[model samples]
Target: MTVIVRDLRPDVPADTEGFARVRRLALPYILFTSDSVRHNAVHVPAEARYRPLVAEEDGEVIGTAQVHLAHDSAEPGQGLVNIYVRPDRTGRGAGGLLLRAAEEHLTAEGATRLFTWVLDEPAHRAFAERHGYRSSRSSHFLRLDLAGAALPALPETPAGVELRTAADFADDPRPLFELDTETMRDEPGDIDVEYTDYDAWIEQYWKHPLLDRDLTVAACVDGRPVAFSVAYTDGGGRYSTAMTGTARAHRGRGLAKLAKTHSLHRARAAGLTEAFTGNDAGNDPMIAINKWLGYEICATEVRHVRELG
Candidate 1:
């Protein structure tokens, strides 16, 4: 079977559905939907040069790639490509062809370095190494059975603090944005992100297709958000924690833990069966919090990098 790689047609429902299907099968830890796929393809900032590609064989999409520059990072020339082929469609040259196209596009767009995440399996790691990518930091995908696990009781709202949902801030989300920006500064990651673009943030985050505002909990201090747990639900009894963070000023107060717990209780009440979240291997604080919430490590992925000459 001959396979060809080309840019994903965002306007085509079949292409979007196929892309989401591959992602859901290959990386079940994360939430993916056809609407989310189309949103990213259409709403990502132009400076990022985001290009979603698909590998088609006999009119069937067998692989997918999300290619983009690190536009919001202070460091320039850093590009990212995440390629995943259907679990049943491996060994068909689909992944390699997708990577080649992604690399050529990023390199032509001035990328000096490329990064990708490979599942912590021998074959996956071998593929990256064969492509000149070296292993770097790793992360863990965690899972919690909301339907069966006994979650911790919702913490009492500390004096002078109130717990609220993201929906409560519909009239004004700037506070949440500011809080998110502050917390992101300390998030464990390889890239130093420059997150000052509020408009871009709104399009990429606040308006995301999977965002479940009712399930997203935030801790407010005198009506200003200080910590939050962003929630994304797939409308299929699967919920994921997109991000959970506390502003630096509020660190050590357990506000993040409180917010996350509240979010979980609400998620369970809403009938979500499973909960998923990911954390960098080195993020001890968040890891501890997730553990306390009964999350267990389900899988691990290693980041691999290749420097383009």
Candidate 2:
């Protein structure tokens, strides 16, 4: 069976469904949907040069890759290609074919370095090593049984800080955008990101179909958002924390913890029975915060980097 790589046809419902299916099977910890797949294909920034590729074997999508340049990074020519093959389809050449296609695309677009996330399994690591990629930092995917786990009680906010929902900013979400950008700058990752495009953020993040504005909790100081925990519901009783962070100036105030806890409580109250979140291994503070909230490590993935030169 010949495995051929090609760009995903967003207009084809079957293609999108297959792509999302492959991702779900390979990385079930994260949230993914057909709508989100198409949205990313259309809404990503032009500078990103994003390309969603799929490996087809006799018309079956067995592997997928999300390839794009790190446009928001301070450094230039930093690209990323996350490839995942269905667990049942491994041992075939689909993964290698997908990687080669993604690397060629990024290289043609002037990417000097390529980064990918590989599940922390021996087989996955061996595949990456065979391709000249070395392991870097690792991240943990944590899961909490909202139905059974006892969540910490919500803490009282200080006099100057107040808790608010993302819905409160329906009239204007610029403050939340600014706060997100500031916090993301300090996030631990292989590539640094800057969220400067408000319209793009709205199209790609705020307006996403899964984003639960009503459940997303934000900590406000004097009417300005300083920290927030963005929530996304899969409409299947599963809730995921898309992002949880505090602005640099607001760090050490426990505002991130406050926002996250509030969001979790709201999610549970709304009947979300399972909650999932991810944290970089080096982010001790966030890990501690999640642990305090009763989250346990469900899975781990390592970041792998390869130089094109």
Candidate 3:
């Protein structure tokens, strides 16, 4: 059977469902829902030039690719293409077709560097290398059993610090935005992101369909969010931590841990059975915190880069 690659139709229920299905089967460590897939395709920032692609075998989608420019990065011409193919569908050329299509699209968008993530398996790494991509850094996908594992008890709120949920900021999320912007700058990655657009953040993150505001715990000092654990629920008893960090001024205060611990407990109480999170391989502190919170390294992915002149 001949496989074809094409842009994803966010408005089409089958397209979105198939895309989400491919992602879930290939990378179950992360969360993906058809609604979230549609939301991302519809609400991506204009500068991102985002294009979601699907590899179709006859009518069934066996692979997917999320291609876009790093619009938030201070450096220009950085593009990202994350591709995933169903395990049972690999070696059928769907992955290659999707990667080539994504590369061609990003190249047309003036991307000088292309970045992608490949599973640590030999076949995945070899496939990337054969396409001129080189390994840069690795990250671990962690999982915690909220329903079975013992979660750390939420500690007492330190004096002058209050624990709150993202829902409390419904009237105004600018404070959380500011905190997120500040904390994200220090996140370890090849791309340096600067979030100067508040409205974009609200549209892309704060208002995300998967974002569980009621379970997103934050540590506030002086009524301002200083540290936070962003929570995303799949509505299927599964939860994921999208981000967890402390503002620069708030680091070393254990506020990040406090916020995450509280968030995990809240997720468990809310009937979330499985929890997932990712950390850069070199991020010792966050790794330690996840381990302490009962997370186990379930999978790893290596960042691969291909530079185009």
Candidate 4:
């Protein structure tokens, strides 16, 4: 069987379904849907030169890669390529072809460095190393039994504090956007990003297919949001925490934990059976909060980087 790498045809439903299928099989810890696949392909910034490529073997899409430059990063010439192949189709040269194609595209776009995330399994790590990629930091995927797990009771809001949902800001989401940008600025990562484009944020985040406005709990202090837990549901009894953070002024008050706990209760009440979340290995505070909520580590992925001259 000959495997050919080509751009994904978003207009074709089968193409989007196949891409999401490969990603779901390769990384079950994260949520993927056909709509999300198409959204990413269409809404990606022009400067990033984003391309979603799929590897086809005899008319079957067996692998996928999301390649793009880090447009929002303060430093230029940095690119990212995340590749995933169907679990049943590994070792068929599909992955190597996808990687090579992604590298060529990124390099042609003026990329001076390439970064990727590989699951921490031996084979995955070996594959990255073989391609001249070096291991860096790692992140963990956590899972919780939302339906049957014993979630902690929602705590009473402290003085001058209130709990709300993202839906409350529907009239004007600018406040939530500002809060999200502030929190994201301090998030630990290999790349530094600035979210200044409101329209892009609205298209990419606020209107995302999976974002459950009602389940996204926010902590308000004197009528302003101080912390929040953004929730995403797959409409299939699966719910995930996309982000949970507290503003710098609210860090010591346990508002982050409170918002997350409230969000989990809301999710379980809504009949979601499984909950998923991810965290950088070094984020101890969030890890502790997740552990307290009965989330267990399900998998780990290591960040890999390659410098291109």
TM-score between candidate 4 and the true structure? 0.98
Candidate numbers, best lDDT first, in rank order:
1, 3, 4, 2
Lowest summed-lDDT stretch of 10 residues in model 1?
Answer: 186-195
Local accuracy of candidate 3 as per-residue lDDT tens digits, 203-236: 9888899999999999999899999999999999
lDDT of each: 0.95, 0.92, 0.94, 0.93
Give the count of colliding residue pairs in each prediction. 0, 0, 0, 0
> Residues 204-256, candidate 4, lDDT per residue (tens digit)?
89988889999999999888898999999888899999999988988989999
Identify the runs in model 4 with alpha carbons over 4 angstroms from their true place: none
Best by lDDT: 1
Q: Mark the 10 consecutive residues where model 2 has the least summed lDDT.
A: 30-39
lDDT score for residue 241 of model 1: 97
User: Candidate 1, which segments miss by more than 4 Å at Cα?
Assistant: none
RMSD of each: 0.7, 1.1, 0.7, 0.9
User: lDDT, candidate 3, residue 82?
Assistant: 97
TM-scores of all models?
0.99, 0.97, 0.99, 0.98
Q: Model 1, residue 189: what's the lDDT?
A: 80
